[model samples]
Target chain A: MATITYREAVVRALAEEMDRDSDVIFFGEDVGKAGGVFKVTPGLYERFGPARVRDTPISENAIVGAGVGAAVTGLRPVIELMFADFAAVTLDQIVNQAAKMRYMSGGQIKVPLTIRAAQGGGAGFASQHSQCCETWFMHAPGLKVVVPSNPADVLGLLKSAIRDDNPVVFLEHKVQYTEKGEVPDHTEHVVPLGVANIVRRGDAVTIVATQRMIGVAQQAADELSGEGITCEIIDPRTLVPLDMATIIRSVQKTGHLVTVEEAVHAGGWGSEVATRVTDEAIWSLEGPVVRVTLGAGIIPFSEPLEHHLIPHKARVIAAVKRTLAV
Target chain B: MSEPLSAAMRQQMLQRMIEIREIEGRIQELFLENVIRGTTHLCDGQEAVSVGMAAVVDAAHGDTVTCTYRGHGHALALGLTMRSMVAEMMGKVSGCCKGKGGSMHLTDMPNGLIGTFAVVGAGLPVTNGAALTAQTKGTGALALGIFGDGTPNIGAWHEAVNLAAVWKLPSIFLCENNLYGEYSPYADTAPVENVADRACAYGIPGVIVDGQDAEAVYAAVKTAADRARAGDGPTLIEAKTYRYRGHSRTDPAAYRPEGELDAWLQRDPINILAARMIADGQITQAAVDGLKAQAATDAQAAIDWALAQPHPPLDAVHEDIWV
Candidate 1:
């Protein structure tokens, strides 16, 4: 095992995969020579050279559309959108082209493309750069959405996302990049899509979270353990092909659920999780399914307001208590 | 007919053009009969540009073309069989995309027709992407995009063209100046007189040709394709053309000037090519009539075959979302 920051794990995944397959190509604005604005892709251009790792102009449509075109033309392209919010500018390319091309071609074409973007609301970069837009991709049919919370999950899941046949949107939480964790030493390590990871096993209440919310729920579970109230935390690694079987089984055991996410409460992914669990395992629930979200609003620019909008351990603890009260 | 097209090349281009016209005519009949529901975009008068492109490129070497939603002509010109074309419009499981892609989204990559985008100027960047593949592999293949005169006003066109120029990808953007973009005339949408003039901003050569003359379009495309193959980067070519029909099946095109359609018809691509061939003694009037008859027969036969095929399975909607 090796201890590394979440940011380094992303760079390692790119290097390892590009080395494994010659078809894997990475390109984005300031990715090469600039090492990306977030400083995640420093040595890639020097190692893979300019042809494989390129620096493109500020053209989001070209970045994604060309990636789809290249993918169908026989290249596994890994494109970067810089910010998750920037996906709005290239919605037609991401939703209409990449998601529909394979199905539109009736299996004649396959878009083995991975789009990686940084998301979340911790650094107080304001509205344009700090929104959780994973729900938009989750709304698309042919896309696979991955939101990993740790270094090991980032490395393993990112490798699987790049190798996946369909278009995968890997949204890396900005706050978690500096966090440290132990990753497996095996170079071949990869976490498959559609599998939920149980961060902590318990029998009291099931807390289903995504991205940064996993860490929040974990802290709350640790504090609740002292009061003899243990909770099971499930991080749904991928949202589209969600591991509902694990979630349903856990809900059956715990008899309760509290879905958490940093995104707006309106049409958020938490509602999707809550809807599925209530429909499939209504008898297993002893209480009403609860959702903990950032109520329909924007991510503020101030640090204090941003933290206020983001769900903290106290909020998760309160949500757990609320679910038990029901 | 012209100095560039040899006897065999002229014959091939004429046959493909006639096939496109007849297939589009049949599509109209089927739409009226409620045999093919929804909407259909026809490319009757703009056949020369699409068919002219097929006369120059070698699809066997991975050369591909991306065209707009009015793409029946492009599908036929790029070597997609009339049976597949008819089957696709009929929504049969035996179609090119297994009835998944209708008339507006014809896609058959093996035959080099990569895609027919329903949205305007949506495929230009895709062409650059395909060109990027050609350049990286050192293959002398070209990726051509066929859009309309008004596409230059969109963000996608500028972004795609700029990226192609900066990367020097082997790409070509062909603007089939069909006089209008949907309901709006090009004059209303674009500030420029010719779409090719916009290419100057990208530091590439811009050429304009008669869209009604097959040989003229062929020569212009050959020049651009050669330049791309030689690593000179992308070129923009505006083919002056007009569509005989409205944008889709819904409108009667009452917006056109009273004599505009008649004037454009006087220089029909089929008649222009046929008249030139006859004057040059390359093809006789009787031979032209015979070719026309054979094209009609082939189109009718394809329609019959397409009618016999079954609709896609009910559960097919869930398939093809993944590999």
Candidate 2:
């Protein structure tokens, strides 16, 4: 095992994949000589050279559109968008072109493309930048959405994403890039796309969270454990092809659920989880499913206000309590 | 100017143009008879641009082409079988895309026709990527992008051209300046008279050709393709063409001015090519008439074959949603 930060884990996974497959190429704004905006691709440009690791112009649509084209032509392109919010600029390319090409083309083509972007609110980048929009992609068919919480998951899941035959939207929380964890040293260690991880096993209530919210859920579980309220934390590593079996199994044991995320409450990934649990495991629930998320409003620029909008450990604990009361 | 094409090649080009016209005519009849559903963007008068460009690109050598919604001509030019294309338009299981990609989304990957995008200008960046693949893999291939005048105004067009130039990728951007973006005329939409003029901003060679003249288009694309294959970078070629039919099956195209349609109709690509062939003694009028009859028969056979095929199975709808 090797101790590494989330950013280092990303670079390791990309480097390993590129080493393994000659068809694999990486590109984005500043991803070449500058090594990416967050330095997630530190030495890739020098290692792979300009042919494979390229620096692209500030064109989100072209970045994703070209990736789709390259993927169709048998090249595995991993494109970086710098920020998930810019997905709006290239929505037609991502949601329409990249996501629908295989299905629309009657399976004549396989878009083995991975679009990586930094998402979520903790960095205080504000309204335009600080948003977890995985739900937008989760709602889109033909797309696999993944958001990893730790360095280990990042390494394993990223490798699987690059090898998968479909297009994957890999969301990395900007706040968690510096978070460190133990990652396996083996190159063959790969986490499949649809599996969920049970971080804490308890019987009181089930708390499902993703990305930065996973840490908050873990912290909340620890605090609740001191109060004699045991909580189970489930990190649904992938949103699409969701590991509903795990979440349902946990809810069956706990008899309550609280879903947390960094996106706004309405039409959020949490809402989908809450509905799925209530739809399939209502008989096993002892109380109504509670969702811990930012209220319906844009992320503000003020540091305190931004902090309030993002779901923290306190809000998760409050949601766990509310679920217990129900 | 003397024609750069041989007699046999000229006859072949004329035959291909006739085939496209006949196929589109059959589609129109089918639509009227309620046999085909959904809207179609027919390339009635833009056959020269598609056939001329396709004549030069060697698909077997890894050359690829991407086109916009009005892409049936390009599809046929790029060697997509008539049966598969017609089956797709009819939503049959035997379609090239297995009925999933209807008329506007025809794709024949094995023949190097990457895809026909429904969105305007969506093919530009994709073609750029295909060129990048050819360059990186040392495939000695090039990618061609066929779009309308409206596409050059989009941001992707600019980005794609700039990227291709910077990378010195083997790509050719062919703009079919049909003088209209749906209902809006080119003059009303773009500030520049010629779309090729915009290519100067990217430091690439830009050429304008008579869209109705197949020989002219063939020569221009040949030069550009040669430059690309030699690693001389990308080129932008604007074929000043016209679309005889409406933007879609439903449009009346009443927005066109008086005599504009008449003036363009006089310079029809099929007629121009036929006249040249006869004047040059390459092919007699009787031979040209025989070719036209053959094309009509072939188009009818495709339509009949597609009609005989069954719809895709219910479970097939769920299939192909992934790899």
Candidate 3:
């Protein structure tokens, strides 16, 4: 096993994919020369050259539309929008064009494109720059929403995303980029989409989290462990091809459920998960499915206020504890 | 392009234009008969722009064209059979898009009708990506964006054009300036007099052509295609066309001024192309009339075949969502 940071893992995955397939090309604003806005992609241009590794203009529509066009024609383009919030700029391109091209074309065209963008609020860039817009893609039918929490998951899942024959919205929390973890020294380590990871196996309440929330859920689980509360942490790596089986199995085993996410509470991914659990495994539920999510209103510029809005360890712990009270 | 247009090719172009016109007229009749569900934007008067530009597009070379909701003509020009297209409009399983993509979203990937987007300016950026593939892989193939005057004022238009220019990709931007963006007229919506003028901002050559003249369009697109295939850059060609039909389903377009339609009809695309061919002695009036009769016959046969096709299966809707 080798130790690496999440950012390094992403870079390594991209390099390995590009090395494996000449069809895989990467581009975004400042992604080539400047690596990326969050420095997730560095040294790609030097290895791949300008044609494959391009730095595109500040046009999200074009960036995403190009990915769609290239994928349908030939190339497997993995483009980037500096922030997940920029998805709003090209929602029609992503939600309408890229997502539906394959389906709308009656299986004539396949958009094997992967869109990588940093999401979740911790950067203090306020509402415009720092928002976890996972729901937008998860709600989209054709898109595969993959958000990895650790370095190894980042490396493995990204490689799979590039190889998959569908459009994938890979959300990388900028906060996880610097976080270091032990990565398996596998030559072609690929974590397939639609599989949830059982991070912590415990009989207490099952806490389902992803991206930065996985770490926060871990912290809560650790703190709750001292009080004899064993929490089973399930990271739903992908949202669209959601592994409801894993979550339901965990719910059946533990008889309790709580979801923690970085998005706002209403119409969130958590809400969907909660409804599915209720629909599928209501008898197994010991209490109501508690959703620890971001507060209402736009995320503020103030760090303290933003901190309050984000679902931290305390909120998750309270949510997990609330399931026990029932 | 070295030699003048052959008599056979000119005859074929006129035939295809007539075929498109017949299909469009058939669709309007079907809509009125309540056989077609939802709205359809017909390209009744803009056939020359599609057929002429399509004359230079070698679909076998991996060339693809993306167009707007008014795409029945574009799809036909790009080689989608009338059967598949009409079936799609009628929501049949044997459609070009298997009934999922109706009149607005006809797609035939093999023949290079990439997609017909309902949203304005959506195809331009996606088409650029196809050009990007050609550039990256050194494929001589190109992509074309067939949009209306409405797209220029939209956000994706600027984003798509600027990026194409910067990359110098092999893409053709064909603007069918039909003097209207949905309900709004060009004078009321766009500031510029000509849609081609928008291309100057991107530092690309924007040429304006008589949309009613097929030869003018064919010549303009040929030059642009040569430049694109040679790895020079993209070109914006605006075809000053008119749509005889309204924007969408069941509108008479009363907004047009008195005699505007009449003036446009005086320079009807089919009439213009037929007149040129007659003047050059390539085609006779009797031949043109015969071609028109054949087009109507073909449209009827296509519609009959489409009507016989079954509706998409219930489970089929869930299929193709992933692959």
Candidate 4:
């Protein structure tokens, strides 16, 4: 067992996958000499060389398209988009080509590509760099959405996604990259998709979160424990083939729920979880579901406004309090 | 017949053109006859571009090709069985896409044909994606994307080419410049004279070849293929050809001027190539006539096969949603 930050765990997973398979390659902006903007791919360039760990131009379309092409033709490509917002520039290649090639060709082709993007809002990077666009991918069929909330899950899920035969959208929270945690010592550890893990057992409220929000949920749970409010946190590793059953069962047991995400409140993953909770386990709820999310307005460049744009522990704790009211 | 066809390759090219022309013609006739369903686009005048370009890429390399809505000629040139194509158009089970992809969605993956899309500028990115795959996987294969002159104006076209150029992707962008985009003339839509001229913007080689001449198109594309194989990056080729038919089956081409059609008809690619073949003593009159007869027979046989194929079951609609 080793203590590693979420970022180190991600880098370790990538290195292990590249070492295990000769066909696995990595490419993106600043991934070469700089080890990526967040250092999630640090030391990969020297280890794999330029051909395998390439630094591409600032073209997001090429970054993603090259991965799609390479994946379909035999190579397993892990492409990094500097920020989640940049995926919009490669939508044609990602949504139209990579996501649909398997079905479009009537199963004649398989796109075993992994697209990694940094998400979450903090550090005042403002609007362009901090949006959690996981919903955009979750809405798109033929894609697997993975957002790990801890170092262990990050390592395990990243390995699983790399091994998946279909295209995967792996989201890493920029805020949680430096958060330290203990991961399994086994190099072959992998978590299956569509399974939600109960990080802390409780009965008062079920706090469902993704990526950075998972850490926020844990903090809220720790704080709420003093008030006799035992919060149960569930981290859904994969969003596309969502483990709705686990969430629903938790809601059924707790009778109250608080969902959190880094994206704007409207049409975000929080909204998705809330809708599913209401549809499947509404009768079990003692109070209305609380959603802690980024403010609806555009992410402001100012430090205070950008901080306000995202949901911090205070907001999550407040949301928990509201859900437990009465 | 005088050029260098030898009555075989020339014969095959003509049949492919006719199949495209007739399929479009028949699509119109069938629409008028009320047998075929949905919209129809014809490649009546620009047959040389798709057919000629396909001659350079071999299927054994696992190469891929993408095309736009004006893709009948492209589908045929890529070696999709005529019977499967016609069946697909007829929405039959035995069709290429099992009738899911109508005329605009013809595909034959076994032949290394990626598939066709109806979106105007969509194929460029898809082609680039495929080319990226070939380059990264060490496939030594190439990808060809066939689009019209109007596509260059779309953001995808620029993005696709820029990406291909920077990555040195093994791809070719074949511009079938028939000089028209729906009702608008090429002069009004395009800012430049030749689409190939824009290649320099991306730092790639540009070639403007005679669109009507099969041999010329083959030669130009051959060079691009060689460059791609040699890791010289992508090339943009503008085939300045004219379409003999309307943009779609029902179009009367009311926007065209009177002598414009006559002028293009005078330079018909098939006639010029055939005349050269005869002048050069490459083929005899009887041989040329026999080639045409053989094409007709082959076309009829394809029609028979297509008609006999069974319709796909309704359950197939739910399949292949994901891999």
Clash totals for all models, in order? 0, 0, 0, 15
Off by over 4 Å in 1: none
TM-score of 3: 0.98
In order of DockQ, best first, we have: 3, 1, 2, 4
State the weakest 10-residue window (summed lDDT) of model 2 chain A: A317-326
Best by DockQ: 3
Clash-forming residue pairs, model 2: none
Residue lDDT tens for model 2, A1-326: 88999999999999999999999999999998999999899999999998999999899888998898888887999999999999999998888888888888899889999999999886779899988899889777999999999999999999999999999999999889999999888898799999999998999999999888888888998999999999889999999879999999999999999998788888998888888888999999998799887879789999998887888888888888887893
TM-score of each: 0.99, 0.98, 0.98, 0.92
Off by over 4 Å in 3: B1-4
Point out the higher-scoring one by DockQ: 1 or 4. 1
For every candidate, give the share of true A-B contacts it also has. 0.77, 0.69, 0.88, 0.36
Model 4 chain B weakest 10-residue run by lDDT: B1-10
CA lDDT of every candidate: 0.91, 0.91, 0.91, 0.81
Q: What tens-digit string does per-residue lDDT give for candidate 4 at A179-253?
A: 999998878989887899888899999998887777778887888898888999988888977899999999999
lDDT (10s digit) by residue, model 1, range B1-323: 34757878888888789889988998999999989877899999999998888887678998988999999998889889999888888888999999989898899888888899988889998998899888877878999999998789889999999999999999999999999999999989888889988989999999999999999999999889999999999999999999999989997899999999999999999998888888888999999889989999999999999999998998998899887
Docking class of 1: high
Please provide, for model 4 over B84-193, each residue's C-alpha lDDT reduced to its tens digit, 9 standing for 90 to 100. Answer: 87778777887887776778877677776777767776767667767766776678889888888888988778877988898798989999999888878998988888
| lDDT for position B123 in model 2 | 89
- Model 1, span A124-204: residue lDDT tens: 799999999999998889999999989999999999999999999999999888999999998898999999999889999
